[model samples]
Target: MSSHLQAHAAELAHGFSLCELAEGLGHLDMDGADDVLIMGICDDSRHAKPGYAMLCLPRAEGRASEFAESARELGATAIISVGIPVDTQLPSLHLDSMGQAGTLLRRMFKTEQAGAHLYGITGTDGKTSVTWMLREALSRYQQQPVWSTGTLGLMRSSDDIRDIGNTTPSLLTMHAMLAEACREHVHSVVSEISSHGIAQSRIAGLDFRTAIWTSMGHDHLQDHGGYGPYLAIKAGFVCDCGSHGGNVIANADHADIRERAPASSRWYGHGLSRDDVDMGWEQELPGMLRLRSRGEEVVIEDIPLGDFHAENVACVALILMVSQDIGLQELPELLSGITAPPGRMQDVLAGYGQVFIDYAHTPEALERCLRAARKLARNRLIVAFGCGGERDREKRPQMGEIAVEFADAVWITSDNPRGELPAVIASEIEFGMQKPYRAEVHLQLDRDKAIGEAVAALAEGDILVIAGKGHEAYMEVCGRRMPWSDAEAAEKYLRRKNSGTGLVSEGEDICA
Candidate 1:
């Protein structure tokens, strides 16, 4: 791997002092940074900077501490962040677009055309799965991908998984990643285009040939300000990528994206109806699916569990379909290769029946996931879900309604209640239950307890779905995050129960 790292190293690894870095980007010729004395930058802004010393700190890890440390490590004269107050004077430059730094770094590292190919997948819910799926597919051809999730930060698919900080990575880091890929002569980069990344314009300038929309869901209302704005932010990926753009795989099932696809792009994919598709497909199993189009038949025996993943497979198949250089026929054999994403519809056995852990935090995704799970369930469908703190509140009641509508029992619990009261977020979601629920609904402020209780309550044929915090390894509470894995917790409880310790039931587990 040191060999791979050396092979993919970015020239931008060479750092500069504050003045030199500033001089390198001074007096830009572009829209966002021309003659604009950088005051600082928003994490989301990703406009062009012909010449301007832009401070590039965005991703959660790119906060003050990391930026100062990186800048210092790189021998930068000065670093900037929001933590610097107006009252406290420092050698500072502020810009509206921190993403510009990504562009500038791209240029410095020549990441724009890293010999290593790059690919991106975006949608509200299935970004991670598609990325993983494609990474697994591409690997059969001996290509290792640098992957990232819309929720978690960046990483590569090598044996020594390297964490790249942000989901898409800082421009410098992304450039570095691609540079590394280029050095390795790898074929692709499978990444997710998050709305936050889009809103902030972080991935604005990348050249993507293959783009997939697994499914659409509402989210980031607080960041994008509203539904319309949020949609626009998400549409940026397909809409904005220039001529280097290749085939776009869209979900024919999503109304928001049915006709609203990226402007002037090739289309492919299957759906419930083939009215507007080039490839047709459908769900075959909770984590498996099949797609058939144009003498091509791809059967994914054990794909991944999620209402929208089949559509994601269609999109992925479409990408392979269009990539004449790639073999689309191999999909069937490779279909069964990948496993479940860590938290996205993952199976956990804690108490009675099967426990499903998913990262479905949004109303649309949660409802669909539960409804889908109910179909596979022979007995009770138990849902353990909650919304994140300081996120869009409007979806709460809607999520509540979906929970009540699908699951036989509902347990409303905390999910990343970052700085917000768990009760407050829970109450909003509870209000959305349209009718009185026939199933049981419990409220346990502690997430682990909720999982334990839900697990305990599951019968032989029962299914428990823990939504929100998908693929996330930790749980956030009161501004602090401790180690927490929904799958692990459920599995622990189930193992204990299976080991003759006990059966999980409502209020039975002391943890619950």
Candidate 2:
């Protein structure tokens, strides 16, 4: 697919540019006179001058050997980084990091394409859900080419969804993705914007036609440390957006959200508190909700169910309302007609209870998903969760606390504890639990068994939450990523349990 797209893209320098601020560095370099122009700038692409080659790195596409090969394929020029890498052999100028470099590219590349719009959702929690809901809602309007980019990757179930790397693609990659979307005749794109994406300047120059702010909860504390810095970085995206002045959807119930947003810009808030709102909803169930907005009230008889999803529903609905492009009331009827995103809060009916899948690796995300499971559970809530290796370890215990709060029995299973001892990682997570825990915490580093046990333990009324790894289908161990998926494991376990076929693997499934 990339090859086809590459063919259409104009030939440029084989070397990649460093910063948007460095765009046309070729023009200044006498040595680069013969170099193919690969414009690497620390600015917006819209502002980017014409060049032979351009680079958007530190993106979802990731810096890989293939990416390096792609760079080398260009005519000729320079090689660079967000900052300088040690023992590198290319003309390079160091900056802070790749994220910043991507941001500079976003600033330089001005996507002036007509009718092509982008929606970015950023928050510790609700990012994946919001991104999906928006894409689904917008797709109702056939005229709106609603392409979605999330944990599932860019594109949807039927579409060619490929990996870009980070949950949120880098600014340059985003611009390039938008460029591709434009070339492919898309009208709009929905992207999940994580705090890491924002902090690293990945979304730098890209202009979001509309931005959705899902509820903020404690996440990335190790990277963000305190809530203040985290909130500030996440909110900065909406506040400083672009010159076009896009809509900002926020949750008024959150003090940090309202406080973090710029006081000057017009804002819309939605929640249980409905004195005044662009849109509001009353939770009927986890997935089902009743929505009221613009003098119209509609009962969302069925959607996906989860305690945290109601806010996500309102987010997508409000954006639909503001866009005025689709019949907002018509959404409830579509699910019987449409499909669901792969992992975000997916349910599996098997084992001891109902097993669920979500891409919540952060503390806040775990809390939100668990709370949703609690709300939806007719009985006890059992969570199978784990922390990723080499990530912010601060949230591990907090995640344990969330499970301890909602689940009658919580299984500490490895999500993607890459390179780290699964037991050590689980231990840190145990710190957050309070006394006389509601749930019996068990460490099962083997994710498949963690899921199988959680499911097997359930007895009708229990709710099983498989968090951390959502749409993701692999697990990283000792620096090697292996084929692992929570959803698949849940499905396989349930499939086996329902058929009474495969015996549950004990220690084989869980970490020691």
lDDT of each: 0.63, 0.64
What are the models' TM-scores? 0.80, 0.79
RMSD of each: 6.8, 6.2
Which is the leading candidate under TM-score? Answer: 1
- lDDT of candidate 2 vs native? 0.64
Candidate 2 lDDT over 313-379, as tens digits, reads 7667667766555565675764322234667777655234377887777776777777777776788
Evaluate model 1: give its TM-score. Answer: 0.80
Name the runs in model 2 displaced over 4 angstroms.
1-27, 31-75, 78-110, 242-244, 264-273, 325-340, 349-353, 505-512
